[model samples]
Target: MMELDPAATFRQEAADLLDSLETVLLDLGQTPADRDLIDAAFRALHTIKGSGAMFGFDRVAAFTHDFETAFDLIRKGKIDANHDIVTVSLSARDYIRALIEAPDATDPIIGEAIVEELQRLIGRGDAKGAAGAAAPPAAAAGASLASGQGGWRITLAFEEQILRNGANPLALLDDLRELGPCTVLPDLARLPALADLDPESCLIGWTVTLAADCPREAIEDVFMFVRDEMRLAIAPLAEGVPDVRPGFTLDMAEAAAEPAAPRPEALSAETASHPLPGKAAPAPAGAELNRRAEDKGSTVRVQAERLDELMDRVGELVIAQARLSQLAHSGTDLAIKAIAEEIERLASGLRDSTMGVRMVPMGSLFGRFRRLVHDLSRDLGKPVDFVTVGEDTEMDKTMIERLADPLVHLIRNAIDHGIESREARASTSKSATGRIELSARYVGAQVLVTVQDDGAGLDTARIRAKAEEQGLVQPGATLSEQEIHQFLFHPGFSTARTISALSGRGVGMDVVKRTIEAMRGAIDLTTIPGHGSSVTLRLPLTLAIIDGLLIRVGEGRYIIPLSAVEECIELTAADEARSRGRSFLSVRGELVPFLRLRELFDAQGAADPHQKVIVTAIGGTRIGLVVDQIIGSHQTVIKSLSKLHADVTMFSGATILGDGTAALILDVAQLVSLGQGRADDRTPEAA
Candidate 1:
């Protein structure tokens, strides 16, 4: 087992926390008065600060101290979570992230500037009597506590894993001291032996008698971060109770030594059956430790490299299993074939399990873009309401990551070019606030992610003029709307009269196309002149493995993605002869274009008398691939082609056949495009 790096672990945790913090901050902007949002933001900051300090991110912890305080004030109603506050808080959150991600290059003054701005906004709120002078939570709790005894007795029985969760007991004690006078008695009864102790574990509990005139709620707030993992009990001190600090009487000592009362929530079975000696039963709150244990056991953070390595091993196993099955089937031994079949079943299951492990929900990618949209709306002065659908759609992790940049380009284009300005939209009788919807859903075996905008769509006339100016097409060449839209993706092709930071260099969409295509995906563009435009990306669910239909064109075997295959039909000699040099075939009265693989690959042998045409759908276009033979379905482990073969766009990748021979995986999208182009170039009579 590899030893985990504490610093790296902290960084990962911090990154996740930062993401959540950003989301909460964004939500708070819309619901400024939401108490729950305020508390959530505070807790996130507090956790980051504590964890950062513990993991040696001193600068991060230092910066977050003030940030956390801002939210704490909001939580206490001492400040309203208004737009200005949320804005500055977002900036502060970014600076904190920078501090964690790249501390060496980050300047302290930038952080100080953000904090200064935050203080100014907070000062302005203070000028308004802090939201109508509502009493803070601590003060209100104190007022209620003042009605009883002046001091309180508190018991804290922290779970063993509290330290791992980033809670510092000494810090909690110091916070209690800040409230007022306090006396803390350490409970060392549960301390483990030095030889058996885990440094990361927190075994010591605490008993405290506070003479502070602070409220019980204030004391409870001190333990807020670890409250869910610790047992806490608070009660007013009886009059004339001795200060057990100096001389503890029998009763006083006994009371101080007693375990905290069990909370009301039910405990887990394991915890109930094996209660710790002399320790309070962990009710629902204490059960958090058990739950954390179970959760830790259930999910682990494996490195991406490790997962890739595992997938490679699984791929090799699949190939080996295929070879075994091939050997077994070629023989006459029933037992050997049975064993081979069982192994094949196991390998198939393993491949599925491995692929499932690599699948992640699209929401992770979508969540990051929310902040992008928010920032862009502010910068571009376009009040856009960003919406998302089918966030739960899952795709390969590698595909999801690569899709990010492409989606960014698409979204930017939609906002910068497709969306109209407030005034422009008003003149068009459209809503002042434009809408951009980013959605993902499963379409058969592929995932379709669309970035759409309700604004002035593509200017076909302008695009045509640009295309003609660039000599991308003949000056008077006729083109469909889609053909014109395709020009938008050409390198250095832009209709914008002038260049700007966001676009007009004609760079983004081309990059989007290249990236998507590199991931074995295709892009589709549709637009209505004045209504809107939607760009949908069709991508495979996984790049690692797939179900493929293996076929033969002459001597070469090619794999067609099973997901893309609609149906396969025989291509008779009569049908081939009647084509009259045109590649179109009438399928159910539809003129479906077909590509002869033998012609494309320049096969040496004569065409088979019984040829097969595999009809496939790619990006809403159907095309047929004629082959000499059909080799049936296969569990294809995708192995990428070498750079030497990179320019060979006819095949996406390659896979190993059951007989230990390499077969190229046909690029369905490219084949479909080729077929469509072939059909488009034909004479009208041929069409």
Candidate 2:
């Protein structure tokens, strides 16, 4: 029942189609003989051109026609999918996007340049020559016949209140004609005599036969504007059916004169099963066939926001069930307990289903990087091969969408700065073509995504010198190589001797860090001077709900994401008494620093006789958090805190308990860094 803006829908679909086309083209640039990729790219362009024309984007449709023709040649093996051809087509794809977004822009010169480039790539000297040479007379003649394939036969009847919608049925009929070839037959049976006719009321209806190869989707798209106030039946016509004739008659009285016999196909399944094979089975009944056809024809293409909304509702149901289970557990009745158990099971299953809806393969995110690497290599004049692994791993769609920009920035940096030149690589006994591997894997409850390059790695000495010169670190400070590498994320920090358009200005890595942190994720860097460098990003699988280990800090209850908690140990009186101050804990012969939540939060209550230590790890560092009581695990629905407390680094966000009490969600990375003395030494007021 919800209405969507037709223009906005067209734009969204256009962007997706362009993205897919770009990806396939980039792949073909590397593997020119790939027929599947060639066909896929062509299909995407063909669909975009067709849909653009259907939606009144004539300029875009016209511009894309040439590129589509070139790809068509590639599809038919007339011309190979060479790198030069792919590059030119990729540029054309961007031009098509520009045309779709702004057809009226004053940029004739830009269009001319793109067309010239396309002509060169296709081995034609000019657009006129290419158009004349490629255009076939036979194909021109087949156009109208191809467009006249059977499509929707719409029978529309409107009520008297149709005028209230400020719509004219005749205008609606005119609009349908623009979609394809249409023959409209007016139903004069509903029209009144001239003396009795009300000029304002819509008494006449129409039955139209449209011939279009466009799917039922485009047919329904035509009626989107007047769907509510009209009675409409859209059925596919038989092959080669002629246009509807004018002045068609409906003889209702003659049909009422004779008793109709039941169709043999209408017999029950039990009766049909006993039919003799030699007699031939009766044709399917019309009503039964219609039902089956409708079942096959109906489909839905939902926008992602709708799925997110549904997931949120499912999350709410989960929390409500949690509350019910708590109340039922406190009651004495067995019936209440049984019902609560059933509710818990059902809610859990529903949660999984909702999460599944949000799950999308990493391939969708990985596909775009091929194009990124291609463009960056071209810009930098470097030869690089971008390899991806674990693209089949699935993650939340929201996470994947947000990951794109950051990933692009990282890939650009890798191609421009991380990889060495072909001469430099050959001198170092490395391959002429540099390699960058983008891989992902599931670690515990988080997704570990890594971008690695086989080139000259980070220069620790240069980085340290840069850090000191920029006043990012204390003068004469003794820091590890890893600490020096972290300086790459500082704002306006770049070690490049020469600035280039692709990178060098050093504005992107900082943004990547901020974006990842905002998602409650962390980014880490690992490098070997001549081997290569790898940047790994660890992120939670979902943002909405999480498994949390609840604990009490002073009078406030906080949750530590269960994914980060390795194990909990009870600190005995002897161990607690022996260890004091900023450091303590010797677990499995490894010294781990411990922080007491009571002391950290300035609690007034005395420490419990028995304290619990929750061991947690971030990256490679392990630390322990001393808490009063381990309140066990919970399914937490994350609710962000207000702007007033947004700067609080200790708490990532907050959530509401079933009892209407608030519990802060602990930031494990911040806590681990604090316990390891990695938090900023300067006070907030000082900064």
Query: How close is each model in CA RMSD to the real structure?
Result: 5.3, 10.0
Best by TM-score: 1
Error of 2 at 507 (Å): 3.5
Put down candidate 1 lDDT per residue, 101-127, tens digits, no spaces: 889999999998998998888887775
Go through the candidates in order and give each one's C-alpha lDDT. Answer: 0.80, 0.74
Clashing pairs in 1: none
Name the best candidate (by lDDT). Answer: 1
> Per-residue lDDT tens digits of candidate 2, residues 1-687?
876565666787788678867877887887899988986786677666656765677788777877877776665445666788888888888888888788787375777787777767777423444454453787767544434345657666565655643445765676578667888877666667899988777767677888765445345544443443454555556532222211112233421221221122332232345432221221111112123457568534587889988987987887788888888988899999999999999989989888877888898899878877888788777899889999988889989988888888888888777899988999999998999999999988999999999888888889999999999899887777877888899899999888877677778898888788777788889988888889999888988889999898667788999988888998887666555433477787666777788877888877777879999987777879999898889999888788998778888888777666779998888888787663234211210
Candidate 1 TM-score over all chains jointly: 0.87
Residue-pair clashes per prediction, in order, are 0, 0
Cα-based lDDT at residue 162, candidate 2: 57
